[model samples]
Target: MYISNVTIKNYRGFNNLKIKLSKLTVIIGENDTGKTNFLRALSLPLSNNSLDYNQKRLSVPDINSNCIKIFYKSIIEDEDQEIQLKKIPKVSVTIQFKDVKDFYETEIVHKWLTDADGEPCYEIRYDYKPKNDLDLLLNVKDMLKDCNASEESKWFTLPVEHYEYQIISSNNEKQISFNDLKHVVINTIPAERDDFSDSNSMKANNILTKLLVNTLDDSEKNNINSAYTEFFAAIEKTDTFKKILSSDADFENLKDYINQIECIPNLPNLRNILSNITLGYGDDFLYQKGLGERNLVFIFLLFAFYKSTQKSFNLCCIEEPESHLSINNLKLATDFIYKSVNKSNRLLQTILTTHNPTVINKLKINNVVAFNGTEAISLTDVSQNLLDYLRKRPNFDILKLLFADKVILVEGPSEEMLINTFIQTKVNSLNNVEVISIGHKGYKTFLDIWLRINKNNSAKKIGVVRDFDNQQKAKEDHDVYDAENENIVVRTTKEYTLEDDFVRAGDNCKILSELFGTEIDYDTVAQSMKANKTGGMLKICDAMLSPDKTFDLVLPSHIMEIVEKLK
Candidate 1:
């Protein structure tokens, strides 16, 4: 089962947020946009000690040092309107799990310390039912405390203190702890190395002790270490270090010599199933292994461990999977994640965080959670209306608004793109012009909107650029065009002489091949363009450069050119 949604209030960076998760959800944003804290919020539900079967009391897990602020219901009107801030070490989450087709909801609460009044620490609570519904309230904390209080009873009380789950550490016979229960609920997605801090080693060890039986077996571990040492020594003997080692194997030259052999500091012990193994090496050896290989090994280990699990994880939290991986490798990593989930017997829900645009673009738009500094916004917000409209209507261009501004309707994307480039690069300050391709039928539709709306100063200025298909028909076009309309203009190119099907400008084609005999092979470029399966010539920017960089270059160019011509 996977968590379907999360809602946050008065948390770090978010005043209020409610987000629905997809099977594969990706969070993307700039630095300091609270993306990391968002992950912490999700972890809060499971972080509660009551869920830990082990009764060891510890501070709430501080993924980050910044504490969340809380407020009680206020009495005064002004105080109620204003934020009544309290140092909230306590946080709560409402976790909803899906089985078959139905949803089950539960609450997990965490607290940092006792309140100022010396009262029981205020814990965050996720109400399962709507406030107005008025049903029997279920308090997870009370249920857990009750279970811990009674041992002889069939129901085991959840513990009220923090400790790793007893069941997790290799002993199959141990009674389940609250910690084990929490871990089971949270383990929807396999944990990636990037998701945790250096303390991750400790956490990982604890997790593996429970999941991988061999990890807790002393005999198995020792035997694996011995085998690993032998394997390493044999591999080293084939290296340059081996030549140095044999020469220096001389009984330390008595007291005068130290061990001069340089070999890999340590190799991963293979005895433990995938998750429990580590490949530690000296800094010198790190350079010998490429970053790609390091990431590959890291992912392979996770993949192995994930495959080894008998039970499926409910949620997997991965941070920046694109790190140290190239574009090609990122795609491969994404494919691997997709395949890994599909292979699992249980429903695998993924929470992947990334800053890479390629990874962002690969996701179905609805699955993306975009952070805008303070909060995470879904693509659904922008596309909601379009998505609704499309249920009955097929073949609708939802992104038609992309060129909806004071549109300068043109023949096609190639022409629109070229005009945009020319306006921005050659023309100065064309703020009012928006270049759009109207694709014949769309041209008439846009023309009507332009005529009806351009009367007001706020309305967009409109222009039409078309091929003068035949010189004789040009008079009809010129006659219909009211020169008196200041908001609109029409332009035609004479290079084609009205006989040619298309315009032949400066370098014979819209895309220049040989710039003044430089011989750039424009045909090869055209072939490359064809290979890129996107809509129009404008997509060339996306193919050749990054989204941010391409948009930065094109928008101002078009605006400045139109502004310059209008002035």
Candidate 2:
């Protein structure tokens, strides 16, 4: 069974949020946007560990509501049956919580006792009244007096308040054990993992020992024990052992203690003998490696052991798997995570939270979830064609758009370099914005890219700066594009092209003539600028960088307007 959907309400930072799950889901967002909280909420129902909802997981806005509900839709497919007769059941598990004081009075508790919805509700309910005859009489003295009861008479009986807790399924309100849901296990690899820590090493050892115990049969265990006994006997016969027995005071004391016992212990138990074994490569321990290498080795050992044990799990939550990883290692880790989801005999779903573009770029765009502070917006809403186009375009770095506070979309490399320099020199306040050159694709294409990016990152400001190709045509069609989007700013120039605009803005012809060491007129320079656009722009950019000249005199007002809008 794998989770198909999760609904979280009254949980930390998530009042009412529902996110769809795929085989592999990549969650990306800015810091403190509830990415970690989202993962914690997912692990709650499937994890056996208890979470303190009131203190740590409760939403402040929902404190008055006094409850937190996390609902999951698990999809179970029956492959044992024929395809025509197969059943795919969508099971629902609702984990509800109420303050301890209101545990009994909560509506969810009441529903568990009386609701006939045929869905399981795991909650606490209670039945309370008076306890015993004397206690009941004392509690209801007026009723006892009305009934003519006395100390000699039989004391009236009444029920006392007591709580009952169970996992009540919808099937006739039958109680089921929470262990019945053990098939769905949630494992989390937190972001702050330290493989070299003593606790983590112990955990790894325990997991390895458990896997060994479970994988080996009794016959194999006995064979291993016999072999270990032979090795022990050989070691006892060694010269070193005799030397220790004769010279070491500790060995003499151990021998004396063993003689005092009724029966000396046989060979140490094989399981306990290897319990303290530490993994190492060659002569160096795994912990002695670099942090990044250790993280990779630890993660690999965990997943490899998990896969070898043939255990099934519903969901795996991995936070920042790219942490302390190089680009190649990050790719390897992400690929392993993706491949593990569709393993042959297991149903595993993975949820990953990452800031690394290497990981993000490797994932399918449709499986991405972008989290703002208030909500999670799925990038699957973007047109598949556009995503496909982006995938094919190697030069387009979508991470820049996703991570930047604002984006400036231009036409080509010349515009990119010039605008970036301009922003750096003139508009120092807008340092968080990125200048993206989307090639020579016209204003419509720039708008299309802007819209696509806005769909996923609507909170970010976008600026589209394109040259008006024809001055006469622009005058007739001033409303060619809508200027109504509050999050976007569209800037157009009245001049024929960027080159023409540069020439008109300042003494560009004079600058070009001085740079090229030739006498060039204004019209000739402007026309030649179009013939060698990149070369002309490079010359102008170099001039701007020179301490002898200042290009600020030619700064365009529309460019400044775009930067201001972004700010």
Candidate 3:
């Protein structure tokens, strides 16, 4: 079974985070918003990975920097008592599970339950503490007990050389570890790392080597070793070697200096020989392939290897799948990852953190989580038709709206182009707010994202800008998006369409009519725009780019309201 819940506190860049994980969970956010930190934090409690212990160990850097700052500030506030009862900042992560089955799974999760006698639960907890020993606080206070200004200034750096941490069972108040058993494993593939490079051997290649070691039994290994040893022993006795030796004997001084130098090839066995195998297209090995191609192949091979080898639950955390990938290759890689987990018989779970829109386009809405530093946003109860529609058509840039601080949704490309120009030129160029034209698929569906997120904290502002066929439809649109507390504002064109409204706006028709170099009124301009929407918008936008020209084409008040409100 997969891990259902993860609760994190004061680790890496994450101040605090709690999010339920789907079997194939995708975390999308801009860089350094704790997406990678979230992945690293989830890796703490998991065991049975090749480098999990070494990678999971806590250091001074592992503790949240802000938490450390507050800890240093809070320590010596009370001078007389040396230390008060303020709780020292500590980092802890607890992962709860669902769908746990079988004796070993039950036994493993049983030891790490949150409560012993209260309720049936399954969780694994890890904590990094401030006080490694009883006298830590007292000694720290005494060190800074009495010091001059100069001495005290130097002593402000009160961080630990190394922090002590432990994995403990909440059920029994005892230190615990899952390393002794290979029941569960977690493997992390980092972004921007050349794991398959020849200059630096991949640390993860050890897993492949270990798998080979386990696969071949002792007798088979012995036979392979014997064959290599015998072949090496026979090399010196060959006729070619005898002739070379005889020739060396004639050169007495050289032969005397050498005494005896025998050729000994490196012994090959199942254990270490796999590393020597050149993998890739014939001449170009894995290290020599293009970075993107190598990365895709590396990921594909990794998933296949895990699928074949894993018996217990396996969780693979991949960060930034779109690194160095072309569109086709990225599609293939993402498709493989999702399909391998869901369609296979093996228990392989994947959690991905990405900055790429293509990754989000390939995933289900329910499985994608927006990591906005406040709280993760996950789509729930979304219709199946919409979910499949997103995957089928990747052109919709839902990801841009997901990451923006504020959003402006419009009807078509004409509105998108014009509004963007209007914002950049007329307004002060509000950078945080984004304008996305959703092609008029459905306005309400896009609002569902803000609905899930604004529930917790209604800080994210969303402006829905669309055109109505009639004034009656505008009233219905207003009623649909009329959520005051939700921070959403709906603005529709006063007339039937954006073109109709634009023609009706003050001096906009005169300006466009002058630019078109012909006499045109509201009806002619509106009908022409409706027929050739992109063509009409492109001509106006192309002229707006020139610094020598200026057109006082006023926008509809409602359009400006959506843009300015989001701003």
Candidate No. with top TM-score: 3
lDDT string, candidate 1, 146-240, tens digits: 33222222211212132121221111223334543453433322224433213333433434444455234688766766766676677777866
Return the number of clashes found in candidate 3: 0
How close is every model to the real structure, measured as TM-score? 0.45, 0.69, 0.84
Which has the higher TM-score value, candidate number 1 or candidate number 3? Answer: 3
Poorest 10 consecutive residues by lDDT, candidate 3 = 147-156
Q: What is the lDDT of residue 258 in candidate 2?
A: 44
The C-alpha stretches of model 1 lying farther than 4 A from their native spots are 47-91, 100-180, 185-287, 379-567
Model 2 RMSD vs true structure:
14.0
- Models sorted by TM-score, best on top: 3, 2, 1
Q: What is the lDDT of candidate 2?
A: 0.57
Query: Scored by Cα lDDT, where does model 3 land?
Result: 0.70
**What lDDT tens digits, residue by residue, belong to model 3 across residues 1-567?**
678878899887777888888788988876667888787787776664653343656766777777655544445455333333243557898877666677756765666656424546677778877555335556555665564332243333445543567776656757775553256667777785566655367533554565556566788878877777777789978998767766355666886555477766675656666555445455766677788887887677666666665466778888888889998999999888878878864357888888777787777667788877667766656767667667666767776776566778887889889878776675544467678877654677677665665543455777877677755754585547655445788877777788899988888888888777646788887877777899889888877766878666788888887766765
What are the Cα lDDT values of the candidates? Answer: 0.45, 0.57, 0.70
